[model samples]
Structures are given as structure tokens and as C-alpha cells.
Target: MTQHIQEAYGYIFEPKLIEDLCIVAAELDFKEGDQLIEIGQYIKKMPLLLNGVIKIMREDPDEGELLLYFIEKGDTCAMALTCCMGSSKSDIRAIAETDGTVLMVPIEKMEEWMTKYRSWRNFVINSYNNRLKEMLLAIDNLAFMKMEDRILNYLKEKSKLAANNTLNITHQEIANDLNTSRVVVSRILKKLENEKQIKLNRKSIDLAL
Candidate 1:
């Protein structure tokens, strides 16, 4: 219904395919804190985020939750290969980190579309590969890199993407993305601030050179 939805749909499929896909896709409005999928549930469809942000997180009883990524409007959430492997895998869950709407499209239809549309098929393949590579790279960085190096690298990359150095991010949020404790993140940030690398503040951080 939103302009972005229409635009993204156009990129993924022809108008008629979108119409057919919509026939099978179910729309759901979720409130904050809603669990769209539970880890280990029989996930049969990919949900297209229509509104709001959802965090795809895996929890650690000891370290807390590790955030994989946030799925915003026009993003898709589904663990396809995990489903194909077997039901032994934990059912992936999409938590409404904030309230959102989703279009649940059956996996079968997605496969059908991939077969019918070369461009869309390539897009899905690339997306899956990219996500996998990002996950692997994150793990490698965490395992081999020093704390200060990682923090500085994170700031540099974020600063580049962000228009200015004043990236509106919280220490807690950074820790979740980095797969570490807030205490560790705060400690590193404090060190960086003392060295004039960044200015820390309540609710957000200002990037410093």
C-alpha cells in the first residue's frame, strides 16, 4: 500500500506476479514486543516487512542476545536453508523491536517466482549469499580483532554511511550489534572518549576524528 512497498515489489517482480503473489500473501499487523516467529517453529514463508523495524536476534543465556540485523520496510525475513536442512534447527523469530506490518508469502510461491523470473531469482540468490558473508565476516572480526580496533572500525564505517560524524546510536545498541556486553562496549567507548576519538552522550554519540 505504501509507495516504498509498491516500488520494492516492482523491483522484485512484474506487476502481474505481484498481484499473484499478493493473492497468496497474508498481511499481519504486529504490535511492539510481538514474536513473529519462535526459534524452532515450522517457518514456511518469508515475511516482507511493510512497516516498522524488527530485530532478528539469537539469544545467549549467558551473554544475552546477539542481534543479527534489523529488518525494516521492504526487507525480507526468513531462514530458508535452515528450513530445508531439517526441523532440528531453532525456529528463527522476528521480534517487533518496534511495531510493524508484514506480508507473509509462502516459500513455495517464492520458489515459483524464482523459477519464472531470472532477475528476481538472481536477486534472491545474491541476497542470501550476502547475508551469509556478512555473518561470517562479523564472526571473524570478533574472533581475531582487538577490542579497540573493532570499535574504531565500527565508528569509521558508520561515520562513512552516516552523513556526519554524529551518529545517533546508543552504547547498548552498539553492544548488541557487536555481540558483546554493554559493560565492555561502555568501557571501550569511555576509553575512546578520553582519547578524543568520540564524544559520548546520553541517548546518542557524536563521532570525533
Candidate 2:
């Protein structure tokens, strides 16, 4: 656990902070598609990603789930941090995008480290700023981009997250993330394939652009 924390956050945290984290943080492993945090759930611990990707989502009563952004290795969810600081339930859902490990830091330590370590304070402020920017980008995509374009952008993001052009995902999964219908996703995907933007496979998409 000490070695893992050092490797993941040594540069961002002071040695004393890292040492304290290894003492208090609990290391956990997650498989792909695992739900780490859900809407209305009280956050007791904050997660620090050591490896892999995690997708943050927002829920709507009528539209289902909308993908907010993805957090990768060495990143922490600002939404989760907010909930921890405010002592409130989580409004966003966090799902593991791939098999990964994370260090769960107790909420009590969050405040202590803020004043105790300069690095921790900067990290928290930067996380909030970065996540806000991503949320704005998500809103922009929804408000301005066409459906086909949105689908293409979504695929491109997934491709980058997966570190491969070939994505092992389905139309329904894309629909769920984008908060659309599977039929609509399939139709737009087909259109994209026709436009030579992507190649459609049985349960996957090979991005060409």
C-alpha cells in the first residue's frame, strides 16, 4: 500500500502526507463495470485512483444516466470530494471503466491534510477546477452538438480511454452513457459507418477517425 501510494501520488503529495495516507487509506481492487459510488449514497471515504479509468455520471428521472467525465490513474473525483467536504450524499455516480486499484482515504483526513500539506490543498483546488471544466464541456456537448457528432465524440473518448481504436462495447451501453435509445444509437452508428468514420462490428466499434 505504501509503495502503491508513492507510485500513484508521490509527486502530488509530500512525503509526510503520503506516509500518513498509507497509514490511514485502505487499498481496494475493482473489476470493470463495478459501481464505486451511486446517487444518494453517503460518501464515507474518498477514492484516489491508482490505475485504470472511472466514469462519473449524473442521473435524470426521465433520461436515465448521462456520462459526465472519466477519471484515470492518478486522478480523484472532484464530485466525491465535494460530497465529502459538505457531508452530503453523492449526486454523481462513479463506475469503474476498467479493472483497477484505488486507495480509499477516510473523510476525516481530508480536512486535516488540507491545512497540513500545501500539496494536498493545491491538489484539491486543482481537482475542483479541472472537474468543473469537464462538466462545462459535457454541457456544451449536450447543448450544441448534433446527435451523430455526440456519438462520434463519445466513441473517440472511449477509444482514448481504452488506449485502442477498437472498443469492445455495444450500442445499448453507448445509449446508456449518452442517455439515448439503443435504436437511435444503432442508427447513428450505422450512419457513421457509412460515412467511413467508424467500422461497426458485432459487439464493438473500430474507430477510423
Candidate 3:
């Protein structure tokens, strides 16, 4: 666990900060599909990912849920940082996209480290900036891009996160993530397949690009 922390998050913090984190941080392992945070729940700790992928999502009563962004190895969730900084409850959810490990710093430690460690402040700022950029890109895609382009971009991102050109996902799953109808998703996927952009099979999509 110590080695994993050093390898994943060590460079982001000063040696003393890293040492202090390791002393207080508890290691947690999550399997695929595990929920890291739930909507409307209070967050107690912040996670520093050691390995694997986490999917951040926004939930709504009428619209359901949508994929917001992905947190991968050596990354931290910006939402987690915000929730941990205050008494507010979580407005989003985080799920383990793959089996992974994380070093969780207690909420108290996170606040303390902000003032006690320069690296922590930098990490927090950079993480927030990166997440904001990702969210803005998502909004831009929704506003300026056509559905076909959006679908393609979504597939590309999924492939990247899974580290493979072939994705083991269903059309309905894609629809849910994009907050569209399954029929629409299937039609678009078929069009992409006809154009040789992707190949579709039972519950899978193979990128031709």
C-alpha cells in the first residue's frame, strides 16, 4: 500500500506531506461497479486513486443520471474535494469503473494539509482546474456538436478509459450514459457501423478507427 501510494500520489506532494499522508491515509480497494459516493450523501473522506478508473456522474430525478467524467490512476475527484471542504452533501455519484485501490485521507487531514502542505494546495487547485475543463468540454459537446459526433466522442472516451479499441458495452448502456433513447442509440450505432467507423456485435463495439 505504501509503495502504491508513493508511486501514484507521491510526486504530487512533498516528501514530508507524502509521509504524513501515508501515516493517516487508509487504503481501500474497490471492485468494478462499486459505488464510491452516492447522491445526497455526506462525504467524509477524499480519495487519491492508486490505480483503475472511476466514473463520475450527475443525477437528477426527472432526467436520471449522466456520466460527467472519469477519474483514473493518480487522479482525485474534484467533487470529493468540494464536499470534503464543507458540510454539504454529495450532489453526484462516483462508481468504480474497474477494480482499483485508493488512499483515503480523512476530511480533517485534507483540511489540515491544505494549509500545512504546499503540495496539497497545488494538487487541489490543479485537480479542480482539470475537472472544470473536462466538464466544460462536455457542455460544449452537448451544445455545439451533433448527436453523431457526440456518440463518436463518447465511444472514443470509453475506449480510452478501458484501454482498448473494442468496448464490451451495450447500445442501451450507451443510451443511458448519453441520456437518450435506446432506439436512437441503436440507430446511430448502426449508421456508424455502415460507415465502417465501428463494428457492432452482441453487447460489444469494435472501433475501426
Candidate 4:
């Protein structure tokens, strides 16, 4: 565990802080589709992703859910950090997008590291900035981008995160993420297919663009 943290996240903290993390960090593995954190649940630990992808989503009463952003290898959840600081529960949901491992640090350690280690403080600030940027991008797409353009951007982003142009997702699932009806998603997808931007299978989309 110590060696793994040193190799993957060593640069984020000083040697002593790293040693402290090694002593307290708990490793957890999650299968695809597993919920790591759910809305309104208290966060007991802060997770540092080591491998695979976790999708952070915001749920809506009428819209179901909207994809906010993704946290991949070597990233931390800014929402979880927020919960650790003062919030009692989480407002967003985090689900494992693929089989992955994460190092969970107890919430109590957060303030200690922040005060004791300058690097840790910097890491936390950087994480918040990155998350804020991604969230703003999501907002821009939802508010300003056309539906077709938004779908295209969604496909491109998912392809990159999956590390393949081939996407194993259903149209209905896409509709749910985009907060639109499946019929609308299908029509737009068909248009994209006619333009040769994507090749559609029963439950998958292969991007040609």
C-alpha cells in the first residue's frame, strides 16, 4: 500500500504525510455499477481513486439524474471533501464506472492534514478547482449547447473516459443522463448515424468521429 501510494500519489504530499496516509489509509475495491456514495448519506472517509472511473452525478426530482463529471485514476472527490469539512451528508452520487480501487482516508484526518501539511492543503484546493471547472463545463453544455451538440460532446467524453470509442450504453440510459426522453435521444442518434458520426448497435455506440 505504501509503495502504491508512493508511486501513484506521492508527489501530492510530503514523505511524512505519505507515511501517515499509509498507516491510516484503507483500500477498497468496487465493481462496476456499485454505488460508492449516495445522496444524503454521511461520508465517513475521503476516497482517492487509484484505478478505473467513478461517475459523479446530481439527482433531480423531475429529471432523474444529470451527469456532472467523472473522477478517474489519481483523482479525489471534491464533494466528499466538502462533506468531510462540515457538511453532514453528500449531495451527489458517486458510482463505480468500472472495476476500481480507492484509498479511503478517515474524515478526522482531513483537518489534521490540512493544518500539518502544506502539500495536502494544496492538493485539496487543486481538487476543488478541478471539480468546479468540470461542473461549470457541464452547466455550459446544458444551458447553451444545442441538444445534438451536447449528445456529441457526451459521446466524445464517455469514449475518452472508457478509453475506447466504443460505448456500451443504452439509448434510454443516455436519455436519463441527458435528462431527455428516450424518443428524442433516439431521433438525434439516428440523425448522427445517418451522418456517419456514430455506428449504433443494440446497446452500444461506436463513434466514427
Which numbered prediction scores highest in lDDT against the true structure? 2
- The C-alpha stretches of model 1 lying farther than 4 A from their native spots are 2-4, 31-34, 61-63, 78-91, 97-99, 152-170
Query: Which tens-of-lDDT digit does each residue in 1-209 have in candidate 2?
Result: 87888888888988899889988999899999999998999999999999889999999988789999999988999999999989999999999999999889999899998898999999999999999999999999999999999999999999998989999999999999999999999999999899999999887899995
Decreasing lDDT order of the candidates: 2, 4, 3, 1
Q: Ranking under TM-score, best-scoring first?
A: 2, 3, 4, 1
* Reference-based TM-score of each model: 0.74, 0.97, 0.96, 0.95
For 40-98, candidate 4 gives per-residue lDDT tens digits of 99988999987889999899887689999999987999988899788588999998889
Backbone atom clashes (below 3 Å) for every candidate: 3, 0, 0, 0
**Tens-place lDDT digits, model 3, residues 103-196:** 8889988888889988889999999999999989888877898889989999999899888999998888788888888999999999999999
List the global CA lDDT of all models.
0.70, 0.93, 0.89, 0.90
Q: Which ranges of candidate 4 are over 4 A from the true structure?
A: none
lDDT of 1: 0.70
Candidate 2 lands at a TM-score of 0.97
Model 4 scores what on Cα lDDT? 0.90
Model 1, 1-209: lDDT tens digits are 53545666666656676676567878889997798777767776767777777767777768766656556665665454346334345545567866778877776777778778776576577667766776676677768988788878877766664446887777877787677778999999999999988898887778776
- In the predicted model 2, the residue pairs found to clash are none
Which pairs clash in model 4?
A: none
